[model samples]
Target chain A: MVKFFHHALKFRKDVCIGCSHCMNECPTQAIRIHGGKAELTDNRCIDCGKCYMVCPVGAIIVEADDLSRIFDYTHRVALIPNILLGQFPEGVSISQICSVLMEAGFTHIFEVEHGTRVLEDAMTKMMEEKELPRPLISTFCPAIVRLIQVRFPMFTDNLMLLKAPLDIAAMYYRRKLEEEGISPEDTGVFYITPCAAKIAAIKSPVGEESSPITGVINMDFIYNKIYTKVKQGLSGKGSCCLPAMQPLQPEEMVWSLTEGEAARMPGRTLAIDEVSNVIEFLEKMENEEISDIDFLELRACDQSCAGGILTSGNRFFTVERLRKRAEEAARGNDSMIYDTAGDSIRDHFDYLNEHLKVTQIKPRAMDKLDEDMEQAMLKMRKVQEIMKDLPYVDCGICGSPTCNSLAEDIVQGKAHVNQCIYVQKRWEQEGKLQPKESMEILKEIWGEDKF
Target chain B: MAERMQFEYNVDGGNFTRAGFASSEIKKILKKLNVDIGIVKRTVVATYEGEVNIVAHAYSGTIYVDIDTERIRINLKDEGPGIPDIDQAMEEGYSTASSQVREMGFGAGMGLPNMKKNADEMHITSEVDKGTEVEIVMFLNNKE
Candidate 1:
């Protein structure tokens, strides 16, 4: 058995309506509808949020850090995602945003966008002599990365080895705090994030572990406070260009947009907008048809971080204005973004890639999958034999997706074979397909069942 | 026609809400059978894509799923006016989806190509006057 460091699918049983929504949406089939409840199979799920996205009644929620958990620590740092900057209303300066975090019980606050500067420098150096895959995929979307592990394992190498904005920011903050003589044991770093995916990533990171950050504060909860402070101009004056904590290079600032990753790297690149669109593009890449593209910038949300579900601004106008701001800011700067102090700083901490130890156990052989392969085969054969005697109209008025899906459901004990619209049509056509016993079964399973 | 496993689905062409019901159910059946995850996914994608295309584009159609120990197959047959050119239809950036379909966040022009890419073998035959038929086969253990 492989030792997985993450928790299994966490279901809020109260919210779950037993609609089989998660079971239907899950790509790995890790979930099943049993006894009118969604049951998850241990060790099968890849932690992709497909089920999380598709639940109708908000039944499923991923395991996330409650910021209240970090209250036990003496000192805490809030590493805020840059997207949170736009979540406030007009006149909110970066200073006011930082101040609200300080006001909301954080000892210190750092912009994660600044962390992108350090990461860009490190990544550029790493890619200098590399023969990386054409159309190298962005590792930024944790949900997308998990999707790759389950559905597109062949494309894993296309991901950049560099850590994401939160991790890199956490690293920069921890180092700065440690240099000031703060002990790692006493300091806790929490990511103020825009989505549930980041919380999942922090708790069970894909590539690395012992994350620089300790937990997350829901951006939804803190948005109003930060906005109110920024609106009231409560914070002291400070240049957005030069913060007192540290200076970020122009290249790092550009990473706020969609293709920002490829813009910083030297190569052919493609930036795909929207999570749903990336799914189709990845399929093309898998087929070896989109070989012309060299690097891919895949943003889960449309308009990059600007369109995160937690952001308060209108995405189109904000993205346009932010782009203009970034271009103007970058015009005069030509300095290298990394620090020489980072060398001694990198050595003091113990860094480990948490996912290095992750391994998947092989599934049992097909014959051994169920002791009743013969029984299943009998059920299938019966389904087919019944299909030959029935009408073929597949209309899902029967509640399944198609006639075939219904027949399979019937075999699997989810539905009765007589639900096919054609079967009813055949009974009407021949005046005999619906004998009483099967009608009773259909009525028993599907209330108000009319065949 | 080649020997097909022969299953049918009644697509609610008028209801956008019931669109992927068939695909979801097929996914479940494949899972219970201990089908290869890759094959199960490919079948589901092709099945849903075809089913959606029929419901949204063609007036309506029946989606068929055929599976054996050796391979899994999907055939989506619609009784609507057929494609003008099958080759042009196979292009990655081509789409015939409606505005209503696009609002649902689909119609990327990648559906047909994605289905083809995922399946190891595919055969499509259609006539302008009659209905169109698409057959896709993904072998259980074969490398593409």
Candidate 2:
């Protein structure tokens, strides 16, 4: 059986050292070291970029659309998240960044958070429907959505069936352009993404049939392009060509930070950041050890999107900067320029709301040993039987994260029982396996060079 | 096939931090065995409530789990102050836990009731000043 799962984080075999760092650090146990290279299990990987963070040799790469793809459309719109503004230092003004994007050939720049205004009202309406399940999990972070689908399949219904802000923003822009006499083919909406999951979500969305956004540009790539222009003093001169900017409200400005959505949600809501923290909390929630939570805002990154793997700035400093900006917006002391053209998102609220909902998300659980119950039971018994001979110590020398995982692999015929160093040592002591034979197995796993 | 798998886990009483360990292990095993998710949720909830009861009231306890193709049975036996009246103890609001345990959010009077609600079959037996044994059985194939 073939299972197709779109993953944005790519593992390059030539660059991997097979050091086991990525294999050990993966939260989903999606990576394995074999033949001196790291292999990613497609269905198991959530594209959370955890392995990308730990790879010392830069073997993992985040695939994004090339910048030149924007030029294909006559109306090029850059849909940027609020975190992009946080990536800049205080000395770099918002207008400077917009001017750089405009100089780089973007016809219009829109803040992705502007769509949150439409979402706030829709979410309030959703909370009013008591028939929905309690603790409605936010679908804000794509990685968290995928995590729930694969790891906690029981909670798939708990996910909010609503489009993310990026989707809303992209849809609104595309429709707005269509109304203005520009064809959909001529209007290209590009999202500046902070993580690989967002890129994957756009490429092959979970609950949605298709994405409105035309392409994706990594935030780091755009940050470098803008910063270099600012340092060269070219951004200030290009401010004359800056389009009328839409000033984001204080709440919308901080909508991607931790507790951003939870603060706005009605009832007893809780926001959890970091993937491991979310996993631990969900485990207890699944066990019914915790209850009465009306809403849950779960993010895959630690500081939310500020800790995105593609972000270039320090997560803490970026959070602090965004918070300060939000305070300024709240106080009406924000010096950023606003567009008087009255092309506000509020004007297109009805149109955006009509397309706000996503379809029901189906669970794609990765835990079962087999599709059939009897076969799974047989596989489970085989794993348990193999586990009796192997030490429980989670030494990753076997290329699997834990001994239990190695046992599972052995049952599935992906690995051999002799791949375990402890089992090999025991067999050698018993004279059942020769040293030369064990060394050959190590060479097969770690490559001929590691010996 | 009528094959069965049995496993044992020790539960340390008065340690609320380690209360749900056994339930988590059982949940993992059931998930790997391709049990229905609805069945998994009910079994885990029933097992968790029983585990917490052992930690909240007993001195120490042991959980014995038996899994077959059709059902999952868990037996939680604890050595501690046994209940004098099983009828009163089964009530939702009746708890003999100390104020400290209540403050720590453990000794909720709902433990037994919750276990009964999630499990397909539940039985409790106790001897005064001796110990308590709780057995919970959940059907894997037929879920309500």
What DockQ does predicted model 2 obtain?
0.71
* lDDT by residue (tens digit), candidate 1, A1-451: 4544364247776666666666655554556543345666544465555566578887776555676767777777777765676555445555666656766677766667765655565656556645765666667766566656654555666666667866766776676677779887888988876666667667877666467678877676678776666657765353222224434445556576787787877667778766668767775554333456656777776787676655567877666656554665567432222333343323333342221122322232221123343455556666666667544564444555345556655766766555655566666568766556445544443343223
TM-score of 1: 0.60
A1-451: candidate 2 lDDT, tens digit per residue: 5665688999998899999898898889998889989998999999999998988999999999999999999999999898998998889988888888888889988889988989988888888889998888999999999999989999998888999999998998888779889999999999999999999999999888999999999999999999999998877665533334466789888999999999999999999999999999999998888899999999999999999999999999999999999999899877567765757788888888899999999988899998777788789889989989988999989989999999999999999999999999999999989999999999999999999
Q: What range of 10 consecutive residues in model 1 chain A has the weakest lDDT sum?
A: A352-361
> What are the per-residue Cα lDDT tens digits for candidate 1 across B1-144?
322344567775556677777777676556555665556656776777676666666667788877666677778888877888989888997988778777776676877787788668788888886768888887876765
Q: What TM-score fits each model?
A: 0.60, 0.97
Clashes of 1: 13
Cα deviation at A355, candidate 2, in Å, is: 1.1
The CAPRI class of candidate 2 is medium
